[model samples]
Target: MSHAGDGAEVVLRLDRISKSFGALKANDAVSLTLRRGEVVALLGENGAGKTTLMNILFGHYLADDGGVEVFGQPLPPGNPRAALAAGVGMVHQHFTLAGNLTVLENIRLGTEGLWSRGAADARAKVERLSRDFGLAVHPDAKVGRLTVGERQRVEILKALYRDARILILDEPTAVLTPQESEALFATLRKATALGLSMIFISHKLHEVMAIADRCVVLRHGRVVGEVDTHATDKGALAALMVGGELSLPRAEVRVPGAVLMRLDGVSTPNRGAGPGLKAVTLELKAGQITGLAGVSGNGQAALAEIVGGLALPVSGSIMLKGEVVTGWSPGAALAKGVARIPEDRHHQGSIADFDLTENAVLEGYRSRFSRRGWMNWRAARAFAEGIIKDYDVRCPGPETRIRLLSGGNMQKLILGRVLSAGPEVILANQPVRGLDVGAIAYVQSQLIAARDRGAAVLLISEDLDEIMGLSDVIHVMSQGRLSPAFARGTMTAAELGLWMAGQKFEAPDAA
Candidate 1:
């Protein structure tokens, strides 16, 4: 019961699927098919309903209309257990493992067993899979202590433990280092060799081109085009996904002005299992975007927290506009004109249950949205309305619960709120993490605009293309210590990659 496709054998199919939440049409008659032993890249912009479609397929949500079939058999709507039993598994953007538990324990969970230390069997299976797929994860290590890449491997292993023949990955490369992403791709290739099918979702076209055997693109909640990866290039896919040539204009470098923010001898405790940052000294200049590029969990999170005033540095002096704010709280930092778009939008940026108006006023409610320590509903609503319009956030006015919006829209809201504050220094960590093509471009443009407006921008991201595209100067961090600053024209991807792996290479001084 395979989908009637040209060459490859179809193992899963979505037929005339449609889903809507009130006025918003999340998926509209979308149809796609996954082939056995083939990697299908699901491409789309942030709000194109790629994730939603995947969710529906995985039984996270029931489609309002239409039906799904696996191997030519009808599927029950909104039944995850049925989907899993039918050999479907998913690795989500946010990990779902219990952090404190051992990898074996995490993988063995949900199994019907009482006496079987299943831990032993799971560990053996994990080791075998790791060797076969090139995923490097310590099976005995506590999930809490693993790096982001390692944690991702655990997620994949968890799915494999369920014997998922068709695995769905949502933005798998967003949190990975270059080396880690390449390794994962190698694993995918290996998995394909073993007759496993995959549905890989990503915004990066290069990845799709490199790994996928076929590509299915979505736009405005519909299947716009499907192409053979071998026959198409990134430009063609980008055009399909974005509806235009992707324009990434380099930001003109303004000579960095006075030191707007400075961190001297900052030695923070290691937040992850990796080494702590040494006495790192760096300066953020006014009217410049300083890119902190590294694989995730290499102290980038800690650095952002320390700079944003969320975490006090164990040993350092943080001077913002010449005033020492070494131990200032987030509120104090905001008052002093430091705006930050946190990495984890769900955890730090916005409260899911809160309405747009409330979330918009989260950071600077005291001054912009309120006065005399009293809530000003009228002022806040007006301000929220302006941000929604200006930032192009699609929502049901300011009263909509932020959780209801898509990941891309939620990010837009955070960026809008941060930009509206008119802060002097902005700390953005993975600012465009889950956004779509257009949204990524928009966010990059907004960062450049902020820089042009004389705001010192600290851009922390694992995305090398983004760093190379938008940064005036690149600073690569490895094991919590930053390399010598690389002027925009001096560093190459290979050079940055080497530095990120702790290779001692001097950056050419002249740009």
Candidate 2:
């Protein structure tokens, strides 16, 4: 049921907002409204202009035509300070917290002088807010030392601390666990009860159905459908976002072959807040998808790095095709027919300043796209063009800097770059983290096709549903330790959750 009544005051409005970059129109005459104490979900496929429109609303971008009104006042174009002064707050998908700063410091950074007498009052208010909202993060904890879920809480607290009446959240739960997501939903309910309005942008339909009072769908940069939450279902919403019925690919029953890659009793040093792999013995079998599920910061990163050849195990041997490998590096991994899809696409997967053509050949340039001493720009461009067509990446051209593309399109480019190489093994790490439903289906289908082609695939994700749906065998990680592999249909989600929480593991022997 919606908290806001029909008679409730309208707190925010967007009227005929139109924005374009080059020939691509990011937003086209888009219009929306938010009532006090209401939650409106903005739904769309990637590149459908969801983020662009939100950016415009938050004053990160200026509309070519039309404007935004906050509580009946016209917000100045492209002035973030104006947006803030108007009590508008935005929490980005990728966090904006500084690593070296404390949570209290991050929240109070621009609001007031750090050494002022108001600092003590701010601390007391933060503690009160945290308790009232069920956002239980330590005020003095360093941001870099916090988990993904904790950092998200800080982001929300930052907005509430500024006395924001309207909050915009972009993919807020992408990295959060199911429990954390439920907690966030509860917090939103509390916020709305106190007369705050919000705009939630998400690809997860179930979440939209649960938390949003109304849903607005965008397609091809324009509003196509709007419906009350009580009137619409998840399937209908999915259809509205993509313009038709959506069919996600399923993993078919299959028998896997020999172990293609194996890690025997691997151990590594701890990094930052996350522990290293602890005597973890694992295998990626030919023609199989090995799924790893865990809470964030539970040694998943170290495991991915090991397989991607970015790190070496301090102990234990890495075997490839029945032979122990040495001198392992990214180049070595590629030479051995291993393709890595990194967790952070913007940082590890591709360079922001590089064009599509340059990123397509980043991993294979030395051996495939380049000769003894020179680069083949013509061949590289053709390869990039082929990937764009084959993977259905939406972009103007290969020469366009990859930073300009939406998250889903960027991921498609990365997938195309790796899969096109015809590798024997694949490392897909959180492959569809922030993508729309369509993109998730496409990426998963590609991995299944690769498995059918006899490639050993390792899928690491924080999403248990995706893991259970796609993997032939599953493993859970907790505190740098790996659980025994369970077949796809053998273990229930509850059973996996036990493992994920470290309740199912035996105590490690003293070293």
Q: Name the best candidate (by TM-score).
A: 2
In terms of lDDT, the poorest run of 10 residues in model 1 is 502-511
In order, the Cα lDDT scores of the candidates are: 0.84, 0.91
Residues 1-511, candidate 1: write the lDDT tens digits: 1122367677899999999988889899998888888788898887788878988987989999999999889989999888999999999888898988888788887864524775566678889988877777787899988877788998998888888989998889887777778778878888888778888888888888888878899888988999888789988898898888886557886788878889989988875476667778888988999998987767787788788887877887888778787448888888878889999899789999999999998887877666787889998899899999999998778999999888878999999999998989999999888777778888889999999988999999888999988888999888888887888979887778778766653446412
Instruction: Give the 10-residue window scoring lowest on summed lDDT in candidate 2.
Output: 502-511
- Cα lDDT over the full model 2: 0.91
Clashes of 2: 0
- What is residue 389's positional error in candidate 1, in angstroms? 3.5
